[model samples]
Target: MRRKLTLKDVSRESGLSTFTVSRALAGAEGVSKESREAVLRVAEEMGYVPNLAAQKLRGVASSTIAVITAGTSNAYYLDMMNGIQAVAQDMDQTVVLTDIAIGGVYDIGRERQTIQRLLEGRVGGVISTLTLLPESVKRLEDWEIPIVFVDSSPPEELPYVPSVTTDNYNASLLVGAHLQSHAFQDWLLLVYPPIWSSRKERERGLRDAAAKAGATIEVVEAGNNAASASKALRDCLGRRGGRLPDILIAGNNPILLGAFQVARERNTIIPDNMAMVCFDDFPFAPYLDPPVTVLNERSEEIGRLSAHMLTEIMSAQIEARKAGKPAAPIYTNEHQLQVPVDLVVRRSCGCPDPTRSRS
Candidate 1:
């Protein structure tokens, strides 16, 4: 194959230093607008690509952000990644996504090595949805790199690292209100024990809503995954005859899947037999025999907003460096962002029969 056109070629052809070419390509300052455009135009004509490894040797940031996720297999995370990629692409920035594998087995060592390598290499910043160990977070704090948390645990005291997430509490309350208005009497709020912060906030919303309406609510612990949720549902159903829950609220998509499995096995017809509402609106929710009712948590918007915050932090750091000021430390902000929860009224929650509902 012909040798790949390199950044050196662009510098030589444009009569600008390689540093100016790098900054112009990376959208960083220090190059005039005209010079930046000229460099880009020549680089495009020359088909020039920067050698990332060589760029690192020159002590330049890779203009890349690392996103560490719990797992890329999850639909929610996948959506989030798409949002992040969309924004990064618009800015002509590159991303490196590292999966923090399930069960924490593949995460610990990999994260440590990855962070060390990034510090030694060319990554500009990191945006993470993985729960960094306390010590690791502290180490990263000391490194002075711009780090933003995306839907993960936030430190109690720090007030700099920004995060964006749904208003889980309000969303749960919305679900609770939907069921209450539907005349659901006895309800079960089923969630996993090792709950994420988002789920915990949702549970609070559910409880608060139920309390307001005097709805009798019972809490059931369902382990993550469909099988465990199915088992938990069965156990709950086995308790009493007329005491069966009129509606079941599943905390997340996995739990909702389990609930569906139990409903199918028990030959339970939705709405007529029992009502159901899920937190994470699964893609197939609308196609079910009785389409699912849900509080549509906008995971993509959450990702986009979090990525925006990360971009803000990175820009600030760049500005600080240009001003010869020390970079700020990573810290969690108490600011809560509220993304509206959509109530997708569907057949599962007894789609209103217009004649009867109006009458």
Candidate 2:
């Protein structure tokens, strides 16, 4: 049988102390770039795999981080994960993804347990898309790991963790302004419950922009699916003397998809009966019946930036610990590293249809 691959093999092959070899492979980042490459190369040649669980037993960092989100079903979430994955690959960090999609009752339980497992493994850090359990936040001080939150509210105003997100309010303002310039009078904002930060902020922005333009605005709430949104739309139209909204701002991509379904059911003409826009852009947005006017949320960039932030926080925490100082975590606000948004105008907004009008 071949000899077993171990840290001793890496240390001997790389002329570095076992500790240095360990740090290099564990993503500690204190070792010089040249030294890290040397250690990693020899370990790879020797087929030595660092055991993360064993490292945790020795109170050492794992070269892994966890990224928890609702699910991979949502295209927006998938884009965010793609961004995070790109950064993770560059940093040679492994990512653990946990999907919570059963229901609210089960989600809370799963999120907390999954986080606890990651903590016990001594993951280098964590980047979560909210849905983290309150208990996890309360016990974060004990974990002492670098943390980053994406598209969610930070817990208890903890100023140490970083957040990566889009400007929901301003994105909404762009949509409202576009409609106002078009002279669309009656507007309807169809969204899910306003409990979500994205929905609440976008609604506020829409209201502000509409008020300034002297356009009438109405709000309607839809359940999580298209069927509910369709029913809601039909009910609104029946109550309004069969008149349709001049403009419709769907709070998110799924909601917009639902609105489009409702429009089809009602046999309404796009931009002739109603104009439509969505808060977040989708992959196939340009191929729709009337290419959609979308407020691009930069979802992928949010994930990429959050990963970078976590890497920075992990580095800082390691240095502070090495210097025997308090590991003062860095909490970057949306202002410090906020992602920008763009409003892409297409045929759906009652503007001249680009396909036919451009030529």
**Maximum-lDDT candidate:** 2
| C-alpha lDDT (0 to 100) for residue 99 of candidate 1 | 67
Go through the candidates in order and give the clash count of each: 2, 0
> Mind giving the per-residue lDDT tens digits that candidate 1 earns over 168-229?
77778778878878777778877765425565777788888888878888889876556677
lDDT at residue 274 of model 2 (Cα atoms): 93
34: Cα error in model 2, Å: 55
Q: How does residue 183 of candidate 1 score in lDDT?
A: 74
Which whole-number lDDT from 0 to 100 does residue 215 have in model 2? 91
Instruction: Tell me the TM-score of each prediction against the true structure.
Output: 0.72, 0.75
Clashing pairs in 2: none
